[model samples]
Target: MDKFDKKILTALHENARISYAELARRVNLSAPAVADRVEKLEHAGVITGYHARINPAKIGYPIQGLIELTVKHQDYYIVMEQLGTMPEILECFSVTGTSGLLLKVAVHSMPDLQALIARLMQYGDTKTSIVIDVPVPLRMPEVVETE
Candidate 1:
């Protein structure tokens, strides 16, 4: 939106729990104005949801990976359904190229990972890659002002 809105968003992205007064100060607006902007932003779907970043390893999910699936046919909805029911699948994406679906998975042990892969293989061929380390952890994208 405007520069003030962008500033508010940048401040909130850094800390969602920031007080309205503090946000107002950062954006050079009154607290009420800042609150109104935040409300509008939420209503407009610019701010969808807030979340806490957790350590998967510390939470007993030592294994994290991406599974690239190349399905047998076009009707892959069944596979998508099954993937939705699986707690191990954190995120799924439909990308172009060879892979029909890409899944982000988290599991506790090697046995669990093997079982997940076996279940997935029933749909079609899959390529699994365990995450060794993340150089850039997930972060909020910048809210640049646009025309």
Candidate 2:
């Protein structure tokens, strides 16, 4: 990717719903050129997908929790696949520590959290911690300099 392509990606990452003309303006390119570059990016798998960021509290899911799980074996892919299918599981990661999987879950209430934990325990050993306050839940990616 060139400098223009990098600028386009940076703008798109901030707001995926931006119009091609607006994106072109930001990147100092013509709309057609921006469209072509975006299409190429998508086709090449550089732009995998676009998603809407949602507020957990606004949708009645006020509770957020992190779960650390230790499985019987190193079958992370299978476990991650299963966890991904669950709606409550917001994110899952494999870390080099005591736990095999770290999961971020959002729930409506304590009962919902209990149910989620119960269901997860069926697959492996689990430990959980409810988030009281979030100073920084998520952050936007900074502009990365490309060679």
Candidate 3:
């Protein structure tokens, strides 16, 4: 990507809903030119999707935690499919470690967390760590021009 493309990405990363005119002003391009670049970025897969960041606590879920699962090799896919059906799971990742999967989850209460754990235990051994405070939440990398 060029310097202008990088600037557009950086601007969008800061605020996805920015108007084409505003983006054009920030990038020193015409509105049509900015729109074209953004469309190209989207088509090229460099720009994925836009979303709103919401607080779980504000929406009834007050507790958040990470759950690590040690699943059998044969049961991995099964567990992955099942995870998709569970709305409490915010995110899941397959990482290189003793644990096969790591999950970020949110719940309404301690009892709900316990119940979720009970359900997950059927798939494999689980280790859960509740979040007390978020020193650093989710953030995206700033787009910078590469040499």
- Choose the strongest candidate by lDDT: 3
Compose the digit string of candidate 2's lDDT tens values, residues 1-147: 788888988888889999999999999999999999999989999889988889898998999999998876766667777887899999988778888889999999999999999988877889999888989755456546565
List ranges where model 2 is wrong by over 4 Å.
Answer: 74-78, 140-147
Q: Write the per-residue lDDT of candidate 3 for residues 1-147, one digit (tens) a residue.
A: 889998998899889999999999999999999999999999999988998888999999999999999999999999999999999999999988999899999999999999999999999999999999999876667666664
By descending TM-score, how would the candidates be arranged? 3, 1, 2
Q: Which ten residues in a row have the lowest lDDT in candidate 3?
A: 138-147
CA-lDDT, candidates in order: 0.90, 0.87, 0.94
Candidate 1 residue 81 C-alpha distance from true site, Å: 1.3
Mind giving the per-residue lDDT tens digits that candidate 1 earns over 1-147? Answer: 989888987888888889999999888999999999999999999999877777888999999999998886665988888889999999999989898899999999999999999999988889999899899977667767775
Better of 1 and 2 by lDDT: 1
> For candidate 3, what is the TM-score?
0.94
**How well does model 1 score by local distance difference test?**
0.90
Where is model 1 more than 4 Å wrong at Cα?
Answer: none
Model 1 pairs whose backbones collide: none
